[model samples]
Target: MATIYESKTTEIKPFTYRTLLITPDENSEFSIKHSRQQPKHTKKVVLLNLVGRTSTDDIDSYESLEQANLFPLAHHIDNDKQEYEQYSKGLVQHFLFLIELQRLWKSEYDELIDLPRSSRGKFSFRKSDKDTHQYREAQIKALLEPIDPSQAIARTTATEYIGVVVKFYSFQIRNGYKFNKTPFEYEVVSIQYQGDSTSIGAYLGKDVHIKDLRLNLGKSRGNEGGALSSSHKNLNPITNREWQAVRNIPTNTSQVIKNVAG
Candidate 1:
């Protein structure tokens, strides 16, 4: 008899934040609807930042502010239930990404991952030898690099995730939840949208300047001919054989259709 060997694969679970749906008490001031007859119960999405915490019940005051900053957007009057829920979920994912980057930094440098709290108890990241905007940005990019090329995050998704984190920091700054040294450095640049000549901003001679992150992720200068370089270096059009195979798929057969769909 021959001995048989079995290969075991371990699955890595992604980090996630906790959310609670709670109905306010009768005396509570929380109310989304202003109708004469309010519903018996109204639910609210509470996003808790449990980045490195061991217990969900161990949230502090500073963490409360971090969680509360997302409440306005999560329960915005303009957004419906589904829309608000999505926003909450996206915010949680973005925060988790930052937490992952922080873990990478801590493992590499053997130092505290998060910004230090000030004497007044406000979040602040004062410039230091170990902590600087450039150093942090480099660490973030390094962590974001894909270990397996096939499992890489899409450029658009990466951009959106970072944008959400930047916006969250901006909101915290505006609400006095954080002081000096934001998570990322940003610049205001006027963006001209193509094929929007009749837009109000264009007509009114107003340049719409938005906060742009300075992480320098996918930046490229034009070539000598002044043409912008292509970012999709590995992308290629399908060959005739590939196209024919796709076109000749036997969808009428149940097994074939199932295989194609999968």
Candidate 2:
């Protein structure tokens, strides 16, 4: 369902996070051993509370409305480009999962909404819009298999949740025990982004603490000599196996897609 926008003085709650799933202990060995492990599948579930307005008119029309409303509105009234795009993409994918689940368990679940028509052109839910649907379908297909309606429908459900936890740890081994300058050698199991200069969490392994990943918010690590050197950024050090698993993904999307898709 589209997000509801209320007119009263609204006190929006903070976004909540959750651990969807934990892979098998053996699969998690990549992080525990601080080296690349065999290519193994894994998954995790994350819950994000999206607070935004959705119009009955259609999501596509909002772009035009923004043009007409141009400058007079407060900055907060504007949609956060990154956040909104991310949320919508995620919501669409999750909604697709719900549809698939409903198909599988018709008696237990009902679809929240019918697919909306595209505002820009005549696009049906089928292959009419191949470019858009391809990505959305791929994302949804991955999710349907992993999502367990047995748990809460969404992460916010009060009961226990296990189906959402992510599994899969695949990275390559370079020089084995060495920590630096290894090709494709990073195993970022998890990340926490606050949208600030600091405190970008990257859990590489059970051991090996990297200070830059946990800097204080609004602070610059470069001033404190925590800036990663050119070499550090260049060395992916992943094994052929793990690299293949994440090969199709672009570097910039690696963390967010991995975390959110789970």
Candidate 3:
């Protein structure tokens, strides 16, 4: 069901931040060994919240995701320019564990318009959007399956997240690490889903150095920094694997695909 949006005095748009997800060891001290992705420092993190519980109806909900996208899903390896043509496929894609942003926006696309009054975008939600977003992340178990590929290069692909026009912001890796490069944040502005590029596109004008955003958000660590909001208040951030609620997902993760279709 649609979430009722009663215009609030404080309009909060989602903001991206770089964070690390680290788990504590038996000693109760943060250790690199206690992680999923097992980054040398910490795993990348993102902000996600449960939508609700899932039931059999989620299958239909998954099928319904296509209607939300402006793109069709796939394109030839070779396609022409017009540069603007990339977004034709539609927004939603072959997502096993994907779902709409329970807390992200719709009007974010209007940022280019420069309206006098600022407001949060109207997010697209399925009638079952709430029920769908829930527990579905369990599919990450499927998403994390070991790919046969030995080495991987992390890069942004256009076919992913088509309907959002993002404003880029830059930040560097936390202090020092094995690798060092600035990561940029993409703020969704409009839903004119377009072609993908490693770069952010030249809409800002000529001479703009377009950089492809290849990054992921990570879970937050306590003592590492920041306090949790009231919701996660009692939850101990230092506890090992505290963030991981669903453990030991099936090797055959069809459940995830069947569940989190969007």
Candidate 4:
């Protein structure tokens, strides 16, 4: 396959490949508005080339490959299908190994667990629905009995959208919740009102699913003493129970490095 090196000053990330495809007349679409435009060749390349199945020679023979049918290359469509499948299996194994290593480190260091404990500021808890007032009232009472009398914990109620799932530490929301009982260094802060999309990648190469974590100060709809203010009119409805984004925190990669090093 033909290789081209891009200048380092450009905004694109570096890419490595095993095979490449070059398509002519790329500017045809753009040229429709301006006939004098020149057509450029469109180039495609496969990264982390799989040996035998993917190579410099395979670029020319792709139209004949069955796997090429899946990718729309100019050569053979079935010739290297088996090799492609094997490559996929190996990729999954590698991803799982990385995830397991992350789990081991978190267990030993409790990296994510210490953030909330370190925050000395006051915060209220909230719920996702308001339909069951009696149940929520009792729940709030039970949660507050053990806190230091001077430290007041309020309940603010809110509602979650249909099909929205939250990940939170249940024990953390309950009185007598101790830091040591949490998983690895992770604790159940609350099953409260944060919104999360399906996890796209947390395990094998195939976008394995896992719990998505979020942090915020606001409460959801069903908590006691809730309010609707003019300021919240345009916030995302899915996470309306709380402000969609956390503001006022300084974010930097150095903190992640510290969490890892700790």
Please list the residue runs of candidate 1 whose C-alpha ends up more than 4 Å from where it truly belongs after superposition: 1-46, 51-75, 78-81, 84-90, 97-144, 148-151, 173-178, 182-207, 214-239, 250-262
Q: If the candidates were sorted by their lDDT against the true structure, best first, what order would they fall in? A: 1, 2, 4, 3
Q: Candidate 4 residues 43-117, lDDT tens each?
A: 322222212223443422212222212231211122222123223232222223333433444457655564422
Model 1 has an lDDT value of 0.42
Candidate 3 off by > 4 Å: 1-54, 57-69, 72-212, 216-262
Off by over 4 Å in 2: 1-83, 107-262
Residue-level lDDT tens digits of model 1 in 1-262: 2122111112122222233344566898554534443222224444443422223433232233344445543344323232334444445565444444455554566335655323322323543321224333533554366565455544455555555555556666556665545544444455445447566554333344355453556543322221122322355685676555455666543322221111
- Note the Cα lDDT for every prediction shown: 0.42, 0.29, 0.27, 0.28
Most lDDT-accurate candidate: 1
Candidate 3 lDDT over 1-262, as tens digits, reads 4332211111112322233467787899985433243222212211112223234323221122222221111121112112222232211121212333323344344667744332222222332232222212222222344243232211123313222322101211221221221222223244333445655863432233343332233443322112212224335443435333223235333232221211
Question: What are the clash counts of all predictions, listed in order?
Answer: 0, 26, 29, 27
TM agreement with the true structure for every prediction:
0.44, 0.17, 0.18, 0.16
| lDDT score, candidate 1, position 202 | 43
